[model samples]
Target: MVIKMRLGKTNLEVNKNGFGALPIQRRNMDDSVEILLHAYENGIDFYDTAHFYTDSEAKLGKAFEDVRENIYLASKGAAEEVDEFWKQLETSLKSMKTDYLDLYQFHNISFCPKGDDDLYKAMLEAKEEGLIKHIGITTHKITFAHEAIESGLYETLQYPFSYLSGKQEINLVNKCKEFDVGFIAMKAMGGGLITNSKASYAYMNQFDNVLPIWGIQKLEELNEFLSYDENTILNDELKKAITKDKKELGEDFCRGCGYCMPCPQDINISMCARMSLWIRRFPAEPYLTEEYLEIMENTNECIECYACVDNCPYELDIPRLLKENYEDYQNVLDGKTKV
Candidate 1:
């Protein structure tokens, strides 16, 4: 079965399931190379990595030098300055063992890169120099993604998208299609919040123009997606599963974007705010340990200063959500509820 699509306005045709290279950081170099090779052999040819992701690009470089021309390599840089931008681009090119990238994105920034800025100028010069084929941007904020699409400055917009996404996110995907901007769906599994792979795959299958980058670290996870045929469609069961997840997860759930960090209480707001989801979606043991309990305990120290709430781009009432999750977590510790 052939599952291929054109990424936005880019000429590169790749499988709908792009390999998100973030999770590969957990594995050794040899293991990461093995998984990359296996994914390539099994039909995934689009790879996304970032300068922030430690050694992910280097690992892909090791595995992809031979298949250089055959795959679409996309990478991100966290540079806001002119010099930092060039350094990132050069380092990415050197580490990937390639002279050019299929797409180079501004990673998780609040503002859109404009041609007038030195950073954007760097991208233009890089494209002119054949260092990057197209320019793109990735962000956790929906409004920013929409703004990028409307700006028409980018060839693609990578954003967090999944079955748990609501009407706003769906509209963002539509905007990308309308603007001819490539829509790269990140966190398709909801940052490991979605436990059902088949359901996630089927849900994403509904969007023809959207390309989901599944973070592949394990061969077992890679095989699960590869096992599906090109014509994989959502049926009553899958539809029901997706609907159930959307309903249960709701719009209020923590996405783990970590924008609400550096809490005055020193709480890991990213983890504690979504503690309920963690226990429900993943193994209960890891988060239930004493170490995690202490992390949850820190939630009690929140000064209610609303710092996180003010900073959240999603406009989420983070303090209220954190308090609720902390209560639920404490209940679980008290044996009042089963995870």
Candidate 2:
């Protein structure tokens, strides 16, 4: 049987485990369409995408043209102004090949300003115009998430939720339940840091209302989650493995939220964190090139303006971590270590 969960304030129902379209953007159009159709055929009905995920909306639009009505489509807009918001909403609808959206979210509104009334007003107008069925917001900041629930404007909240999350982070799940707001969990695998799929699935499965969208790029990853229905619960060996992973992961710092993105120095903050994981996990991947070393080393160029530190959801010492990663990346580039 397929797993299903209810999205708040709307009549729409989605698979408890859904597909996240972030990783699939890396693939070609044909490959992306093939993977999306495969997901749809395998009982995945809830698809999440955003305008920022280059060509992701177009790929989904092409793949789901025939079965658009049979699935729920959630898309987000990052526009701050009403005109841009409306433009994005229309673009999203046109790109998704849908007349109306199942859920329209304010993409990554981390720090909502005091007089940001136009954004909410536009969302309401969109709903009235039948452009959207429900309104939602996605944020990495827990404080903003709490405020979203309190604001009563949004029907759902999407954020990071995984076993690595602390009590404060997990508390969002409880708050969503209490507020009757749907909780769509992103980065469930810790952005690929949590290597143990079964343990990750089991941990997420314990929560009834939280839906974790696994960013499945390959058939192997899809099959792994699809296989969990028949698998047993946390065994002793599995517990040991999870414990070992937790210890190695150390204290949760960066959530890979991409808030530190578009660094004025052109440093890719998110990929830098992932590179650290690659060094630890897949040391044999040959894509870690000398050019990649330059990007990592650019972390040393950080002006220490504390922009990333202030914006980080996990409150990580981003400059410090980037410095450490630069050293490690240099070691890997120097043939002293593998990454």
Candidate 3:
């Protein structure tokens, strides 16, 4: 049987687990389409994409045309102004090959509540114009998410939710249920920190209102989630393994929210976190070269304003972690230890 769940306050039904199209954007068009088609054939009906994700809208548009009526398509726009918002909506419609989007979200509203209102009004206008079926918003900030739900201007709220989020974020899940707002979970795998797929699936399965969109690029990862629908349960041994992994991952640090982006210094905070894992855990000798050291050290330019730290879902010490990572990266560059 297909695993299905009800999106809050709407008649729409979707797969309890959905496919996130971010990672697949890194792959070639043919490969991405194949993976998306595989996900659809295996009972995934909810597809989340954004105009920001390079070529993701176009790929999903082409792959799902035959099955479009049977699926739910959610897309987001990063537009802040009225004209830009309208332009993005039009671009998304063209890219997705659909006249009406199942859900249209304001992407990553960090602090500007007033701006959110403007966007909400535009979405309402769009809905009136028959361009969107429902309105939604996505955010890395828990405070903004709470506000979105409380404002009742949105039908859904997408946020960074993984085993790594703190109590405040965990409570947001409950609040979504209380407010009858659909909770679409992003970064369910901790952006690759949660290596165990079974653990990730089991943790997400505990939430009834939340629908996790796993960024599946390969058939293997897609098949893994598909297996869960077929009755694959996490055993005692697997539970123990997950616990150990969580402990090692530590607590309260960088939810990979991508808030501190487009740094003036060109430092990639999100990729640095991922590469730090490679420098510490995996065989990343090649990445530890002088060129890579320059990239790691570039984070020193972070003015210590704690902008990223404050915006992080897990409330990580952004500057400190960046500095610590720099040191580790230096050691690896010097050949003191295997990266």
Candidate 4:
């Protein structure tokens, strides 16, 4: 009943359910190790992390240091310079306690790296040195993702994909299949907006080529995905949920991908832009914390530079969105708005 798929030319037969290690950084090392070991003892074999995810790789290293060969370890680096790229590579290798990575990806790139690019050269060198088995790139932009696949410089593509995906996103998946490029799906739950796990699982099941990495923080979340390993079906009820989600999510809302990050004003644009929805959908108490109040107040300092807008793959008017969410957030704080 175990669901496994081959990851394109890399030929990594990984479990359909990949362990996304981003959320584990929030937990203490002991808790993180327990959850990771629980996942490994279950059925997960593909573990994905990134250099930016603080201590996530080290936690995996501690948990699976002795069993490194049994699982596929993939991590990403966001370095731009050649030397920095090497440093990131060495840090990941030492942290994960592995000599070679099953897959090494250029993380969340905005442009398709060309052969002449130094970062691309570094990736080639790493593979040549047997430091990384295969080269891949992750991006949120659809055009650049297509460019990466057509360029034939990468073996895998990790992008935001979920049941809420529109036709263009689905076409990208088909294109990866056509080019024999592996597709690694991130944000499979619409960044915590899609509450229906069965719907997400069923939608991903329709794709034979995708490997969806569910960001697991709690054992309950891990157990939900592991339960889907057997007897998953695209039933009418799940299909109805998918249809409802797509209709409601539309195309303009933020998926909280963090691609529009590091605002010049230090505004939490990623979460602030979607504060209106989060305050309503989730519990309101956490959003009203003193730390969050400061973060939201920083939205006033936006310079209208549009740097975030340019980086955003979805092309959202992030400054404008932040203003709207901030106003609503203020109203909520003043008790004028009902939760």
Candidate 5:
């Protein structure tokens, strides 16, 4: 089983594991360069970054300027207009020191681009200018993905997908396959909620149409994915792990996509909503320590305004879930349950 899959119509054949550069933005330049170079040298050829990721694209520029042609670089444009799109495209090209990108995506837009919009015309003009080889879209919205595939606009769709994601999300991957649209799986580790890499590998390996990009900021994380065999397969034990995760996680948990951010109450709804999983899945001390405890406690400020619920792609009952998780956290802290 060759672990490489050709990404839909663009036909960019990538390993099941691609490098996600969002976390790279948090690292200093030197450390970013080291990890990126290591990833490239070790057979990870697909690199995904975005203009909004702060220094991520710049670090990629420094690390791979000499050999940009050897890798598939995908970046996203957050611009909602024609002029801003061009500006962002130029910034990305200049940052990466590249003339064009293998794929340029509309970053998490609420609606699909259309011929009626200035952005669509700009996309065509950019493709004509050879500034972008392929146009794609990334969104947390499942309905928008269906619309994009139906419109036949995007060559690829990047979305949050992991072992914890349920049937509806998996259908998005399969729908992309049916429509010949590339499926790029983000949040493969469930936004750090899933601690098991081998299980992640086994789960993602089941879909040849889907290519998962692991967000790597540390050496250990990168090494975990890199250490897998080329013929990686999901064994019975891994299947059991997947089933157990789904049962415990249920349907209403946060995927941690951060779309419900900028809470008026200054709360971090993403992590706090999933606090139960973080406590159950990883080391207890790091999260239960004073700093994270403060962050989690801020959910007490939630006014139940439904702002987060509105933005959530899953339409989760966020305020209610936050309260539930907070109550659960208090239990573990009180020695009622072990982490």
Candidate 6:
């Protein structure tokens, strides 16, 4: 029942329950290390972090420096140019206290990196120098993900895959299997929208080629995945849960990938656009707080420039979504609508 899988061309045997270190950045160093060490001790070894995730890499560094040989470390860089790529690479290495990354990915890119591109060449050089073991690409765009797999450039494809994924996302998983590119699933819990971890775990177990790195920030969250490691068979009950989630979530919801960010108006587009979902799926109190109210209020400042729409991989009308969520939020505040 212990889950393990091979990462396609990379051939790195990994535990099915990979540790996503992004959320750990929110935890202080000591607490982060404790959570990380707890996950590692529970047989989760394949750790994924990124240069953009503040000090997540450093926290991993502190926790596993002594056990470095026993774990697999993967970090990503989003630099487009050669110099910037190197700088990010060095920074990640220094931050993670690692000599090389087991999997180095082109994080959240819209287009696939080509052989002629300087960034791709830099990856090759890094590989040759043993700074990175395998090259991978992570994207939210279905078309671009297909292009990455078909291009045969990436050793793995990390994209958002959950029970709510529609035909295209499921087909992308099949394509990765057909192409022998490792399928690393991000947002497997639908970026916290899909709350049933057991159902998510079982659904992911059906795909032998797909690995889900559950983002863990606390002991309970880590424990949920660990406890399910032995019971991850997709049962009739779990299937029912998946079906219920799919029907409710439907398509056209944000994955909260944050690709459309740094809004000109300083609005938190990712959170604001998905506020309706968050309030309904999670506790309404958090969003109702003063801090969150300020964030939600900023949505009104949007200039309708469609910069967010331009960057959204899902092609969400971000400005419009923001407007709608703001209206709904007002209703909640006024007691006209209930969470």
Per lDDT, the best of the predicted structures is 4
Model 2 reaches what TM-score against the true structure?
A: 0.92
Weakest lDDT window of 10 consecutive positions for candidate 1: 226-235
- Model 1 lDDT, full chain set: 0.88
lDDT of 3 by residue, 1-339 (tens): 677788887657888878999998899999999999988888899999998998999999999988789999999999878889999999999998999899999898555344347766787889999899998888876678877899877788898887666677789999999999999999988877777787778777778889999988899989888888635456687779777866766674455668766565677887675566765545576785778777777877778777666556557777788877777676766767564
Listed per candidate, the RMSD to the true structure in angstroms reads 1.4, 2.4, 2.5, 1.8, 1.6, 1.4
Error of 1 at 255 (Å): 0.9
- Candidate 4 per-residue lDDT, tens place, 1-339, comes to 579999987988999999999999999999999999999998799999999999999999999998988999999999888899999999999999999999999997656788999889989999999999999999988888989999988899999999888889999999999999999999999998888887788889989999999999999999988888546878888888788777866778998988888887788888889988888778889889889988899999999999999888899999999999999999999999998
- How well is each residue in 1-339 modelled by candidate 5, as lDDT tens digits? 226789999988877779999999999999999999999888899999999999999999999999998999999998997789999999999999999999999999767897677898898789889999998999988888888888888899998998888788988998999999999999998888787899998788888898999999999899989888656678888889888887888877788888998799999888899989887777777788778878878889999989888888889999998899888888888888787
Clashes of each: 0, 0, 0, 0, 0, 0
Q: Comparing 2 and 3 by lDDT, which wins?
A: 2
Model 2: lowest-lDDT 10 consecutive positions: 109-118
Q: 215-259, model 2: which lDDT tens digit per residue?
A: 888878888887775244677887787788778777744556788
Which residue pairs come into collision in candidate 6? none
Clashing pairs in 2: none
> How does each model score on TM-score?
0.96, 0.92, 0.90, 0.94, 0.95, 0.96
Candidate 4 has a TM-score of 0.94
Model 6, which residues run further than 4 Å from truth? none
Off by over 4 Å in 1: none
The better candidate by lDDT, 1 or 5, is 5
